[model samples]
Target: MAGDTKEGVTLELVTGSAEIFGTDLQLNKKYTFPSGTRTAVFTYQGCTLELIGPTVHAYVSNNTPMAIFANTHAGLEDICRDTENGEASRGFVVLVVGPTDVGKSTLCRILCNYAVRKGRSPIFVDLDVGQNCLTVPGSISAAIVDQLADPVHGFQLEQQISYCFGSTTPTANMPLYELLIRKMAENTAEWMKRSRNACISGMIINTCGYITGEGYKTLLTIAESFEADLVICLEHERLYMDLNRDLPNFVKTLRFPKSSGIEDRSQNVRSYGREAMVQRYFYGTRALPLKPYRIEVPFESVEICQLGAEKLPDSCLPFGVSADDHHTKVVYMKPDMKLQHHLMAVSTAKLISPEVLNHNVFGYVVILEVDLQNHTFALLSPVNELPSKVLIYTEVVFMDDQINL
Candidate 1:
């Protein structure tokens, strides 16, 4: 069965056993699914459910790729077990790639959850900036999957490390996106060196839905950066063949069919989801309320920079240098009204320019109001105090109705 929750849903297994995203549900216990959740419940045998609250739509289908998914999970388990037994030299990494609404994220979740259930902790790296599950949109994040994800809230955020890329689509800034991915891979490698269980259990990476042209190239880049041992391509034969031909001989590539339950989401729905993620970051949910602090800080106290390539005429450029040569250049910005309603990342870098471009962000703050005359900015942040003075400007603009209050 599959459905999209509108307001919320309380699901109880009426008969037999069932699982969602590879995590088995308790026989008689109730599970709450929050709004905007798209999920599918699967069972080996027959099962019944009692669903409370209204949903956008719900239905049961006889056709599903659950068997193939289970087999794939079993293969990954074998690799993990072999590594643990010293039969393998290093941890195994699996990269999931496909077009939009092809069940890549779902597959990654199922594999991670299955690994955790088998007493293993795998690193879950989410490179989907368009719809990141671990953090807000326009950011790439990674976290160790030591526990099953909540059906409603998804993954926990305690140990997650995220880097803000500022735009939902990598097409807006491909170089920056690639840079962030490489940096994330480096960090994950460092993390693996510390945790033996995590190293042996390996990583499951989820990528964006862009699977053609430059998107295809980005996949190869990711595979090389992470040194993926296996690549799972969902519902895209050309992509599968391309990866198999291009990737190293040691890497294994497999294609899987998309789930019939997976539905294509409209652009408006995607926009709403992105907005909701931003709101949840600062405001929290109804069950767990958060108090965001609104503080006014002098403009001079912080440094604001925007990431972009220098736009100079070819005549003024060096002989061999092109305009796109400096794709990750940091340009300073003067405080102005234009900054209002936009999200700014508090970067960990102490210095400006090169340092800021290389470092990840500490957190984000929304510019509630920009007071140019007073040289100050009214900001709404989850933390009481800003973590850093270096701020990176992003294209994401959040227009909260509660900002006036």
Candidate 2:
């Protein structure tokens, strides 16, 4: 029940119990869809239902926002042309900014889709760790768009170049979040350098919806990192004004209204949306069923590392151990039973240095139980084998739908 999307799906909870993340669905009544976030409907019992999907359809109705965006894209095409002739170092880097549910992701998808239709292979960069675009929530990911996006699954292609924070909000660990973004930008620059197609095709950088204070500052930081050519703001003229007033004069800004059809989600709803995605990941989409296997491994086979944490008060710390170094250091911990049911990302690198550990995740595993009784570790993962020996513990936590003591 957790994987329903807003694009299209209709079902009647027929005979059994089901819940969307933590919200229970009403039985014998019809449910239409998710507002925007990915959802997991856990049918605690063997559930039955009448389901139909992709039920929504529409014509090529060009709204003002899409039209303006597409026109800007046409200008970017000219930038792409310039890049081809060696007149420019890069093509247009479009950065979209807006408050919650103002149709930022939708605009990104539309722009990318339109570009692909025109035969341009732009790289789509998703910085919104709260929404599932190129990859799961809690991660910033990117991918090259060679084909049009599927209405249902989205641009879920290319294994999605990604980096994770394990939490929904960035300000909790702003410095770490900033570092990861810098790393992603650096890697993306390297990717564009090697791929001519991507260079000309440019990129559409989608960002998180936190648009005030540190969030606003973070958006500006990303714009500077990408050297964004144009900044698009939806539903807020003040945001547009602020960006224009502060950013380099060369960076163009767009102020657009909130789309009439956009869905507004509150903080609690946003939290649930991320929860839904984390669940859908290990549990599989309703279109596909993934029976994740649980296995036991020796305690020494892997290491669990956690990213940024708030500093312990100097009063609470041992003498001379100041809080200054607490922010940048990663904790390399010995695995234990306390890690049970915590979701951990498995990475490909051996990762001896914490400085080199802000890397993409290969996959995820949930600690089912840590058997101190036998000095072993138990984990639940979708794939059959471990991708690597390094495990990064994220703030992301998902409770197993199935009851486990």
Candidate that would win on TM-score: 1
TM-score against truth, every candidate:
0.93, 0.79
- Model 2 — TM-score against the truth? 0.79
* Clash number for candidate 1: 0
**What lDDT does the true structure give each of the candidates?**
0.85, 0.73
Tens digit of lDDT per residue, candidate 1, span 256-296? 99998888989987898888888888887664657788988
lDDT of 1: 0.85
Candidate 1 lDDT score at position 122: 93
Clashing pairs in 2: 1-40, 1-41, 2-39, 2-40, 2-41, 3-39
Worst lDDT 10-window in candidate 1: 1-10
Clashes of each: 0, 6
